[model samples]
Target: MLIAQISDPHVRPAGQLYQGVVDSNRMFEEAIAHLHALDRRPDLVLLTGDLVDEGRSEEYAEARRLLAKLSIPYLVIPGNHDHRENFRTAFADHAYLPATGALHYCIDTHPVRIVALDSCIPGLHHGHVDAEGLAWLQRTIEADREKPTLLMLHHPPFTSGIPYMDSYRYIDTAPLEAIVRSVGNIELVLCGHVHRTMLKRWAGTVVCSCPSSTTEIALQLAPDAAPASYLGRPGCMLHLWDEAQGMVSHVSYIGKMDGPYPFA
Candidate 1:
């Protein structure tokens, strides 16, 4: 199975630029086109979070229109930029999602079991998981210990060194980390709030944060650095999974670039 992970498109309404600068919707469209053009089409796609610039109905409408072009099936979780209720209403057709409360569920049809957790705090930029949400996650993972599981959430559990971005990082860590550490079958904990590709060995498994489909948050580690992002080369993560081989992730950069010149 091949899964494509794209994050933080921050799509704006039609004819509008995201943050009054970059055309994120068009970039997201290109990212979808990129997925379609791949030699092997992805079996599934995961939109990590921040699907729109704002939690407006129009933004979700535009996002829905652009996402309709994707031929592959996809799953979405809410980010701080997304309004929980609006997101739920926008993708009401996705029966896997819960009708009320947190947008959390488990999918077992795929080769890997996907346990997506809702980490958004409604009206806040930071993320948190209440006792009920955490308990749900623990029970969901415990249900299938033999299956290769991928835990999906919007915010990364660890504090990224990036000063500004870390300001809005996930707040419920200790308990969550304990839960993940005890789960033996969790193959990967996938996240997207950081907007840049990041990897870390945590809780007996790995956490891979997908890159943004639009602008990338600048990699500034200085404490005094200001919050900023740039219209950099957008990209996505293609995860190839096989029963024997496990999973190997490759980064596929979007837009035109240099040729596939032979290194040999």
Candidate 2:
């Protein structure tokens, strides 16, 4: 099974740019085209979060229009920039998303079981999964302990070295970590919101934070470096699962670039 992960397009209304610089809508279009052109098309696409910029109805409408172009099936979770109600109403056809309360859901797809948790706190930049949310997650994972599972969420449980981004890292992650440790079936934890590709090992599973589809956060490791982004090549992660190898991930950069030169 092939699963593609795209994150943080931050789509805005028509004729608008994200942060007055990146052309997010256009970038997303290019990303979708890239996915469509893949030789081995993805079986499923996991859009981690930040589906829109302002979380407005119009933006979601535009997002729906753009995402509709995808030939592959996809699922979405809310991010810090996303409004729960707006997101729920925008993608109401998903059926997987809960009609009320948190947008947490579980998918029992072939080869892997996906458990997406709602980590967004309305009107806040930080993320938290309350005790109630944690209970749901525990129950969901415990029910199917034998299946290989991928736990998806918006905010990462670990902090990126980028000081600016780490400042607002997910709060109250200990409980979530403990749950994963106890369940022992989570193969990986997928996240977005850092706008950069990051990998870490926690609770006996790999946690991967994907880069943005629009722009990339500058790789400034300095504690005092200002928060900023660059128009570097955007990308997505492709996860391949096989009975022999289990799951492996690869990053595919968007847009046409240098040739695949052969080494003599």
| Model 1 spans > 4 angstroms off | none
* TM-score of model number 2: 0.98
Distance from true location, Cα of 143 in model 1, Å: 0.4
Predicted candidate 1 versus true structure: per-residue lDDT over 1-264, tens digit per residue: 999999889989999998889999899999999999999999999998899978999999999999899999999998899989999999999999899999999999999988999999988999899999999998988888899999999999998999999999998699999999887989899999898999999999999999999989999999999999988889999988899999888889999988889985
Would you list the clashing residue pairs of candidate 2?
Answer: none
lDDT of 2 at 81: 95
RMSD versus native structure for model 1: 0.9
The residue-level lDDT of candidate 1 at 197 comes to 93
Which residue pairs clash within candidate 1?
Answer: none
Q: Assess the local accuracy of residue 198 in candidate 1 as a C-alpha lDDT between 0 and 100.
A: 95
